[model samples]
Target: MDAGSMKAESRCPLQEQFLQRKNSKENLDRFIPNRSAMDFDYAHYMVTEGRKDKENNQAMSVCSPSKEAYRKQLAEVFNMNRTRILAFKNKPPTPVELIPEMHSSSASASSSVQQAKLNKPRRHIPQSSERTLDAPDLVDDYYLNLLDWGSSNVLAIALGSTVYLWDASDGTTSELVTVDDENGPVTSVNWAPDGRHIAIGLNNCQVQLWDSTANRQLRTLRGGHRSRVGSLAWNNHILTTGGMDGLIINNDVRVRDHIVETYRGHHQEVCGLKWSASGQQLASGGNDNLLHIWDRSMASSNSVTQWLHRLEEHTSAVKAIAWCPFQSNLLATGGGGGDRCIKFWNTHTGACLNSVDTGSQVCALLWNKNERELLSSHGFTQNQLTLWKYPSMVKMAELSGHTSRVLFMAQSPDGCTVASAAADETLRFWNVFGAPQVISKSAPKPNREPFAQLNRIR
Candidate 1:
């Protein structure tokens, strides 16, 4: 009895030490190791350690495909990877090879293959008409998508719920990154002209600025809007926001971003805002049908105390405004255009000049560089986009094809494209088709009854 017991005790410590030494380096048992050797019950300690590890990692760890030997077990857990996929042997696929259908694959299995395939140097395909030898890199079916031109990268916002990015060089609708804010809906989003940051206006009256480059949200602006901020315009570092409660806020969009002042004069909801090309003054239009111009050069305190000019025209709600790109003193109103009524105002005097009859309610307004010609879009029902034809007020082209209410319209910075976002869930591209092909006074009608009856039989 004495000899056998002593021999067993002696073997226990050596075995335990060897197991501990093996585990400390194998990368598997390094996370969990049995330490007790005096009890000669190493299985008990193993069970205890295994239970602890499982309890700590139940939500994260997954069993590894490798063998789990007597002294150690292999496990994997979800983790943030600092090591780049780019460092691997495989590169990302070329832009031309990225097909939307590839996204249907599960990320886990596809990611590794995708990275390798993308990183691999592409081989030029030899072009041929009928399988005869031809020059390489001359394939007819090389692929690329137009959306690829807008933004190569995107910033995820609202706790990784939404994304926002420039779609292309055109300053049209920002790729609207939607966040699951319980369908709270975003009232407005303003990207700084420099493209550094984006300010998102939430339906809950809270404002959040996302740092695009860092891809992490910095902070939130509380007490947001009196109601949700409806319009946001940026002039360099200063942000002017218009809200439903008739409160126009002047915010300092800096690292210590805060509301510097609030200008309250609009009797009803403030609907629109525009910064003069010179950036010295800001023009805002509201539901009160009044246009108010604020001189940005005024000190923050003065801004709140000063009430610039009260434009007392436009009998109905002043829905939209855009400053002339060339003329600092001129502003265009979109609510009323043509015979239906679009108002062009002299920013300096706040006086309405030349009420053009657009034959439809103005839904959006945009000005080109010289500011002589005004491009206006009417509501979705008629789907007419008219160019004021400069000082002449003649009708230009009337664009069609949008089936639902056109909710928003924006012009690209280069003036090469006009984008309209509508309730039909579509984005359309319209440009200079040149020369009118169709004409209508109010709405579309077949020239059948009167004109056909009078016409001679052919």
Candidate 2:
């Protein structure tokens, strides 16, 4: 053979190597892991791998039917068919705007209109206070709960040594009682469920039960704490009190010997206290940054009662405590300046459900009696009241006006108005939560009544 015949018959060494590598089994075949054997994110894997498969399919004009049948068979054996994997009978319909050619000219206009609808607020929220009243001598202390609104359309507030009641029905303000210089300034005030009865916690470490209807002092209960009493809650006739000495006491006001159960948990001043609507659970927050949920059935007159759940997640003092009116087991709590976050809990399981940073000290939290919305009062930087949508925790509105930190908040009986007291020495009322929707009379009520457990309290 001559040189010309050899050159025409053979190729370059580099070209031969390239051709061999191109048709190699290692380059053509890919390793696909058994997705069912390993617990990987199937959706993510499908999304990413599906994109690669589409690119490869586009690169090559020919597809092997036998190889495709093999993949389908593997998917069926593993019960991982793409459509059946997510258990969807059909794919979701694509939004009209997503498909462009159908309405090419009006596409931009239609999308903008849909965007406007989505961005609109669910309901209108007033940006200003409906009414403002001067709160002279109102205590500026963060740990003291000095304001409460009774269900009788009456609001009781402590100013200096006197306690006053403001009627929401007729817009009348009346003086309830004035303490002597020895017992002087009031620390906390709460109205009983009866609305006619009210409890006043004093600086002298005493809790006085009063009759607002007759304007008379019913009785004085003592020996609950060594320091000033700052928190009080009522579960039927049982009056629960918390003081600066880190003690929680349950007093049965119907009997002469009132101290029935003592909760021994907090090491710092107990500043916040609330009872569940069902009256089975009691939640308390303290200056030590701890929250404890106490079971009423665990109460013992023979021995000190222990807490059911001791939550130590707060980085600062927790003074804001509120029970969900619609959910008996759900509780909401807020931390102070050092920890500006609102946390939710499941009282039954003691699980922290959710937490949201409010960017300021949360002073008090209140749930709308008729709706799932929540209103939170804050301290520092704007001193505003924030209305939030539950579950989502979206800030619907920020009602601002107070010049100082809002220390206390109380809801009215109708759940329409909120009364907030700030260090600015003014009490402002905001109609943030809209009027509740009226249900039809023929509507079926739930078969279970959670609050019916209150019958077993005494």
Candidate 3:
């Protein structure tokens, strides 16, 4: 063959093969699937399959030869495959039920919670007096404070012109001293805070001091009060005396010039006198229906008046005065028969905090040391002792035994027992302020030692 013919023949075979490959690629393209159908059409088909299945089942039931025959045939096919594949392979286990014991414990816990919600706090009720003693010839005078309980557990009372000391431990009585009839009867009696000395106020306006243990007259504080001395209070070494002269004198017992300071505020007789526990303030009530609070600094100052607060809220005479031991600024004062009210004042601001109409003549007021309670002695219709809750002023209990008015009440140093002397000539001991006690014979008795030596001037 010729060279040109051979080359032409080879080129013709190659072109044929290329044409064949091109045709094969076009054929495969027609059979292969597209991603559009797989992504969009397949997802739409799956979402609509449930509705289509319901329609198909309904149509198949009507078109089929028999519905029972179709279901039985499908069940037979599924049962045959059940041996190779299990149903509900990923199902969770069942939860266990609670036991009977656990149910009972839960119910009990709920009941206890309910019970605690229904409980409330209860208040305390004070008891009545434990015992009573005869105080024959006890002078029933409203202006006089004749009953005083010493720290040594001895109670001193003035009956007529004689001063008697009653030992509470032994239940025995002894005469301390007696004044002449010409010098007048004892108007008031006060014991020193140390329990060693006793102050006797006479109707003749003479103040006498006596050593309680030795039973000897220490000295007579003279030229202090012109009129009858009705009240007396001891503040350490200084003795304070208030009298009908409407004057309050501060006498230093250790010094010769005992009349150190004199306070004048009331126009009527000064009847009530009390020194605060801190010895910083002095409260005095008078027949002028006035209450005065004095400061300790006034004694050393040159001011004309040493009165801290001048209160005039009472319409009648104010003979009952008591300074609160817990609150220093609180002061309580009771009016006479005409007013018949108990007034509480704040000494700091000179303001009246509260006042209660007792409905009867309030003779004296005593605050409990251990509890927030107040005790009041009354006269007239209800000649009894009423224990009241402070601030609220609620009457907790009413103790009635005395036929006459209770004029004076004195608390022991222990702040438990109280001795009340009434017009019935009886001195009753009440545990109204504290709990009852049964003192045994083996208990160590309180020391009856005498106080430090005083400057005796016979």
Candidate 1 lDDT for residue 304: 59
Model 3's TM-score against the true structure = 0.70
On TM-score, the stronger of 1 and 2 is 2
Query: Who wins the TM-score comparison?
Result: 2
Q: Candidate 1 has what TM-score?
A: 0.56
Question: Relative to the true structure, how large is the alpha-carbon lDDT of every model?
Answer: 0.54, 0.84, 0.80
TM-score of each: 0.56, 0.71, 0.70
Score residue 190 of candidate 3 by CA lDDT: 90
lDDT of 2 by residue, 255-324 (tens): 6678999999999999999998888999999999999999988889999999999999999999999999
The clash count for each model shown is 21, 0, 0
Off by over 4 Å in 2: 1-121, 439-458
Query: Per-residue alpha-carbon lDDT of model 1 for 171-279, expressed as tens digits?
Result: 2223345545663456665666645566776656666665555655656666647676667777766777777788888776553546787877798777677778687
How far is 71's C-alpha from truth in model 3 (Å)?
59
Best by lDDT: 2
Residues 120-211 of candidate 3: C-alpha lDDT, one tens digit per residue: 33434445455666666677788888888887788889887888888888877888888999776898899886787889999899998898
Clashing pairs in 2: none
Residue 50 lDDT, candidate 3, scale 0-100 = 41
